[model samples]
Target chain A: MIELRNNELIFQFPKVHTQAVCRIDFQRTLRIPDDNQEYPLPPGLGSFPINHVDDFTDNLPATWKEHGGVFIPMYQAEALWMNFSGHYPCAIKIAAGKINAVSGTQWTKKLSNRPQDYVVVPDQPWLDGFNVSKGCVRQFVAMPLGEGYTAEEQLTGDAEHGGIQIIVYPMKHDVYVKYMEQHRVFNIGDEQCLTYAPADEMGLGAGGVMRQEIYEDDYGIDSWDQTSGLRCFVHLTNSAIYQKITGHPPLHKPPTAQEYTDSGLPWFDYYADKKALQGSASLSQLTSVAAKKIQKGEGTLDNNENVHPNTIKTIKKGRVVRDGRF
Target chain B: MTFSSYIRQSREGLKAQDRRFSVRQVAQRIGVEPAYLSKIERGDVAPPSEGKIRALAEELNEDPDVLLAMAGKVSSDLLAIIRKRPKLFAELIRDLKSMPDHAILRIARDVRDGDW
Candidate 1:
């Protein structure tokens, strides 16, 4: 079952399909200053308000309703992360404007093993941005399309679609049962929700690299039941357009990196057991959001100063015993 | 519950009771893919044929007739008996619908042993 409740997507699976469950939230976070230095993971401030575009067909741009999915409001240059809570195992494919976020290839309906274009969840708790390197990701920051900031624009040279896109396929029932018993891997699920973007829509651009890992699927590619998949499209609108169209005041604007740092909240680090999947060649080549902003003659962004990099609390996974005096 | 769900429960119960009655084991015994059997359990597909249901009944140690009934199928043997005298059998079966089991048993005993 898939439901949109309280601005988050909750997916539940039956006992037989236990590995097909997950919850997804689009988390608003600080736009890290992209000064070519990797940064620590930022905190999730809140969820961007999301609703079905069909609910406001009359008021919305016909293209949005025609695309037929959901919408969330975003500010230009604001950063966001996909928070995935898994209860079982699942495979998720995410794309921004039809560009594969993992492999940087054009989107395909099927999951491929050649470049491993999808993320295996439960091992991967959350995705902060595009997979641009091993043990790090370029944070996902929103930008106006056609300005050459988005990966889609840089790679494809077309600004046709602007929003994030996602699709998730569940593990086969028998494979899930077999793997759970054999490897005794943790049970959890993660699926992707897509976003459709027209010209005026906001696009996700690569931002500062943060310490986040996307795990390679330990189970073979066939573990996922390609026959059955869940897909959702999420659209992006500016806060002004969001309120004028939806009639709800926009979500409280996200705090800038400077403000968040001054507030004294610590960034985080998630330590996992396995080696993360290495970044793909194409993804590593895209320009950072801050660099693009400067290239476009916008002075270094406001409130984007780097935070004290040392102040991060490490959240360890499993029994990651530290070396102590023994 | 559907025949699919009921059989699924039976299989699951068997797993709990004995060694294991995984979808693969039961489906393989019944000559179907585990995936197909899984879908059947979820009611995504229609119940299997009478022969397969009987095979499933054998593997799960259930009564073939009962399983067939749940699958909305009459055993071929029952179909043959009904086919012998379609109109009369239809009337007889319909007439016996609400009768007490003892009454039907007596009628059955008379027809089988006492007289033609």
Candidate 2:
């Protein structure tokens, strides 16, 4: 018997010519922090919350809960958000469980080889109203590319400097297997070819709005390999929704190169203090007119700027140190 | 060696090989006209002036010195900028190259407007 629970498809298959039963489950959805809440985020990090799990899991394996059940986590939730919202940088975590230690071990071993820590089945369920698979379970350890930055670094305000920080939640082996099992038996009716509409065209129904065309990617899961895991569709709406969900403000207008330079934030200076150390160029040459304006009390820098007395002190100290080094 | 044999070997050495890039693609990357760049690549025209080469390097995301070397030209000012801030130099070049002509025009317009 097989069952669909919380977007994961669980099934019991008998060992060849044996009475023993093997159970398998797949993860389909993830959870992320609510938009209104201001949770701690890594610098330049953005995420959107996805609430539609059943829409994705309408075609479930038969009696999925009978064998066992699976549920989505915050990380998987973020993936769904990226898929529908078109956010480039995103991430999610997955958790699965099994009825017996033997089944759990076998499932874990099979899932261990999967790249990006695709499988992370929990030993026990954290929430009620969920059925745990006795013999087999699996979870996901998914995140968008470049999402592993430390909290301190995230808070340091350097996110915009790097190429748009893109995070992709690659489809995993278990997800493919689960999709095959359910799609193989189900009659999808008119939904056979899941048509995605542009986000603007999606109707606001009981299921909220179903954004379309947001998940378009040049490559599909079929093309995924060791190197291909970094690839995923970057949706534009995902950024808006992520800002909405994470309570982070959006970039109201595109920033110019001069604007970035004028921000006076610390940048990745490849030359370090080469010119300054050489004493060939004055600070006036390196500093933007905006910095000079701020120094002269003619204008104020943006909130992102850290023009503290200590910051100046550190620069002076660096100048002294570099002078000593020379 | 015989004069004829030496001449044959020297001619072979002087003959340039086709390096895979089309003139148009290189011109597009460097933000120049295909016809002009073609002439330069074929040595039918002399290398660009120093200021033009610096701008071309910024547009193509190439080290000014490398571009100059390829064209058999060099300038001390471009070399100084490269030496002072190699990463910034690279970034500025990339940014300039990646920006569209219209975007550059718009930025120029905005700068002009702000100046007024």
Candidate 3:
């Protein structure tokens, strides 16, 4: 099932012993503190409502009902990533536009491969579609739904498909223990079942969000491999509910490439330094303007601007990190 | 080279050889939505499991071994062997591909002199 807490989307399948979570970033620049950055979900702009696909039977296709899972609405070109945590171990399949976005050579085959849907593992955090490692792909990106090449049109009919579908399969406990043995480890709990790659290595520190977390410990296993745990299995069934919730609007068609460019925001840039502007005079003034706008209820808080001017003033006066922005 | 592209090419290639099967017919035979099959053909998704690939191969009258290799998988019987000596297998395939079909057939037929 899917649950949203403090803007973090969590998927818990207790019967399967897996929990997948991602911070829902409606705006790309929302910074998370080091101690709190827990999952592999990347920071990005835009928030979509995630709900069971069964509830919106009238809005979905029979095939979608067959998959019977959760869906999230996304505008064209809007991108987001998911971070997974598991108590046991599970191989996750990310179906974007109803197509498996990760696994196999879809990540390598050029003719059908699009940058929109791909996986980013610890070895290669930022996806260039070139720096891929065979088994460790952890992060999954669902590019804005509704593009001509996406599976959206066919999966949800013409009205829907502006979202992504996710399904998780837990590794059989015996298989998990076997994998543990093969990897020179005797038990599962000692490894954290979690792999950490720092925010900098993940390309998070560049400009999108400044996270204090660093991924130092590395595990040599790929949790996304389907064949690792079980040779044969069944598709985990959804509990059967697919209702569209508030806070997400239906797709009014995604933005055109021209419009996105005119807006002057690249999807994400890993090398750009958005943190150094704290000392710039222009940025200082911009924050003041931003604060006034916030007071007027038309705040540009979500925009790429690094810090609100009032927060900066407090930081300087108090000589401490205010609002968690460095 | 990918299972996705391989399945599609095999599907199209077989259909051209014997114009009897439509994508929908094969999809129905495999018990998948036509769109889902189409996505598999287009490499949008990872190739489905070996069972689905085998079913597709049988329906298309294509060789399952070729499809399975492109799918980056092997039968369970071969998995442990491959896992144990991946480099040896990789080299064996690399060398085998360079051999002519006649030479491969000659080696297959002459077991006594084939170093078996």
Candidate 4:
């Protein structure tokens, strides 16, 4: 089952496991400039408020009613990152408009380690964008789908769906308990119909590449409770359509990279030397928002350039380090 | 989420699945006045006692421990056990807090399997 609390989507599968509840918050952040530069992670300006689409059935389109899950407003060029926290080890599968963020393949119900279509958490604290390379991901920039820039349209060449789709398969109770007894570590519902119009709406597109890592699963394939999982569709509504549907403008408009740089807030760099997963060979071909905008020449960027790379804060990995007597 | 929001959403979620799980019916079944339960749901009043929380948890099919933890209360039964050796239990918890979850689980297992 899925529950929206404090602007976070909480997913749990009671029959599968009791303690496994995952909370995902969509974080609004500065859109890193797509200047072919690898940048650090950006600060979360705020979380966009999420509401159930069922609550606004009267105003939403028929397609939205058919895909009943949740909705969040996003600006034209705004960037977003998914922040994940949960009680147990689980496999999180992410897709942008039905395009897998990890492997850039079509959405699948089963967990596949052949190409590693999902990321394991709490090793993966946040996902910024499409995992294009081993240690870098293109930032998730919100754009109106169907212009052929989003990872979805670029991969499938069709903008049938315009939102983020997430499926969480938590560890089985026995496996989690046994693993906890041995190791102390850490430690979801149904799907909906699959029909959507190609009408222009907010969808995530590949943007600037950032330094991040998607860790390989440690629990092995059989550990996940394949019998049941929770899947949620997070619809991304563009500003105007969102206003017409919700009867109010978006609560927060995330500052652009320029405004954020001027304010002197810190961008971050996380250091972890763990083995990383290989990125999708197909996902590497998608274009960033800025690069695509420059090619199309229809819209202008919101002064998202001129970044100061030296000002970024480097976060050392939190592993226990030995201090030899000196 | 806070105690109030968690209770409200869980109730609403169950109500969405089964309309029989209404506020008034639930409040009456849990042995509290509808208005008081409503106030608790709205955060106007503090959460009820452990008995009420356990009853509500059973009614909503939720883990009693989760609800009790959200309400910032320990289960009375567990409290009674702790009260038996308060100082020793307090020290045990203080040390357990710093250890990893597996270590604590190991301690619990050893104690449960120990000869009385």
Better of 2 and 3 by TM-score: 3
lDDT of 1 at B84: 65
Stretches off by above 4 angstroms in model 1 are A12-19, A181-193, A196-199, A318-326, B1-116
C-alpha TM-score for every candidate: 0.68, 0.17, 0.30, 0.68
Tens digits of per-residue lDDT for model 2, A22-137: 11222122221111121110111122222221222223222221211121222211212111111111121121111111111111211222222221111111111001121111
Give, for candidate 2 chain B, the lowest lDDT window spanning 10 residues: B107-116
Q: Residue B77 of candidate 1: its Cα lDDT?
A: 84
Error of 3 at A275 (Å): 29
Better by TM-score, candidate 4 or 2: 4
* Residue-by-residue lDDT tens digits, candidate 3, B35-86: 9999888888888888888898888777787778878878665686668679
The backbone clash count of each candidate, in order, is 11, 31, 12, 8
| lDDT digits (tens) for residues A200-316 of candidate 4 | 466788988898888888778777877775555668877657777877775666667777767677788767666888888998988778778878986656666658755577666
Candidate 4 residue pairs that clash: A12-A188, A13-A188, A87-A187, A88-A187, A184-B102, A188-A229, A188-A230, A189-A230
Better of 1 and 2 by TM-score: 1
- Chain B TM-scores per candidate, in order, are 0.89, 0.36, 0.64, 0.87
1 against 2, candidate with superior lDDT: 1
**How far does residue A63 in candidate 2 sit from its true spot (Å)?**
52
Range of the 10 consecutive residues with the lowest summed lDDT in candidate 2 chain A: A187-196
The models' CA-based lDDT, in order, is 0.76, 0.25, 0.35, 0.75
Which segments of model 4 are wrong by more than 4 Å? A185-200, A316-326, B1-116
lDDT of 1 by residue, A207-297 (tens): 9888888888898898877765556667777776777777888776777777777767777888887867889789999988777778889
